[model samples]
Target: MQCLYFDQDVTSGTLTIDDPELAGENLFDVSSQRKRYIRNHKYGMVYQNPVKGLRMDFSSISNIAEKQIAAGGRHVGNMQSAGERLLDVVSIPLFRMKEEPRNFSGGMQQRVQIAKALSNDPPILFLDEVTTGLDLSVQAAVIDLIKQIQRDLGISMIVVSHDLAVIRMLADRTLVMLNGRVIESGLTDQILEDPNHAYTQQLVYSLL
Candidate 1:
């Protein structure tokens, strides 16, 4: 198996990916302008904290519209329509579309974050510990929503989470990591049923 490594410099807030196959080259080698273009136009990210991904004071509709606008949407009517549609898609009531996310529950804030991420209609979505800090029932609901979105949108998603149950629910391929190294990877069921590495076995057994 080919292993990909990510090193982040906490002090500088810089992240480097050391995977040739994944990037086809060093991602950081690209010009800053090109990187910005790719980030704005090609990728969507949902942070673990809704506060990181959202403007807490902005109305949910404005939050969605902000992304659309960033992606070059100019027509007010079109942006409004798209924002409303995305809000509906994420299961937020149309009546509450104008409410600030800060006033909503944890689950609702995450849903708004998801809506905003999808506003750009990017082909790839990256979710980072998206269910953390939510109740079990809320986590399950968010996971279900993610699955439904995947089915309906048919977009590629990279989900990062420490929860084994969340991995089992969302992933077809699994990569087991230990101390920032990918120790094992394969089809999710294969790994779960017959983990080769000792650590992987322990994880699988613990899930039982």
Candidate 2:
């Protein structure tokens, strides 16, 4: 699989792009302007902490609209409509759309973050430990929301999580990393059923 390497120590490796817009280009060697273009136009990211992904003091709708504006959206009415639509998609009540994310619960805050991330409708989304700090029930709900969004939007998602159950629920393919290296990778069911690496085997067994 063609994967984007992030925050990894790579002494020598060429990161090639498969997207037709920049096909065969080495991402590792991209110019700063090219990188900015890629970031603003091609990718959406949800951080582990809602604070990192959202402006806490901004209203949920404003937060979402700001992302749309950043992505070159100019129509005020259209941006507001998009923000409301995303909030509904994420199951946040419309009445609370004007409330700041800081006033919401962890799950609600995460939902706002997800809405904002989808504001520009990027093809690829990077979700980093999105459910890490939520309650169990909230985590399940968030996971379900992600699954539904993926089904409805068909957007590619790179979800990073330490929880095997979360992986079981969200991933089609799995990559097990150890000390920054991918130790095992395959179909999620295959890894859960018969992990090849010793550490992977132990991880699977412990969940039983």
The positional error of residue 185 in candidate 1, measured at the CA in angstroms, is 0.9
**What overall lDDT goes with each candidate model?**
0.82, 0.87
Among all candidates shown, the one with the greatest lDDT? 2
Model 1 TM-score (2 dp): 0.87
TM-score of 2: 0.93
Which ten-residue region of model 1 has the weakest summed lDDT?
1-10
Judged by whole-model lDDT over C-alpha atoms, candidate 2 comes out at 0.87
Q: Which residue pairs does candidate 2 place in steric collision? A: none
**RMSD to true structure for each model, in Å:** 4.5, 2.4
Per-residue lDDT of model 1, residues 1-208, tens digit only: 1011122222222334333423564444556665555566666878888988899999999999888888889999999999999988889999999999999999999999999999988777788899999999999899999999899998778888878789888988988989966899999889888999999999878877
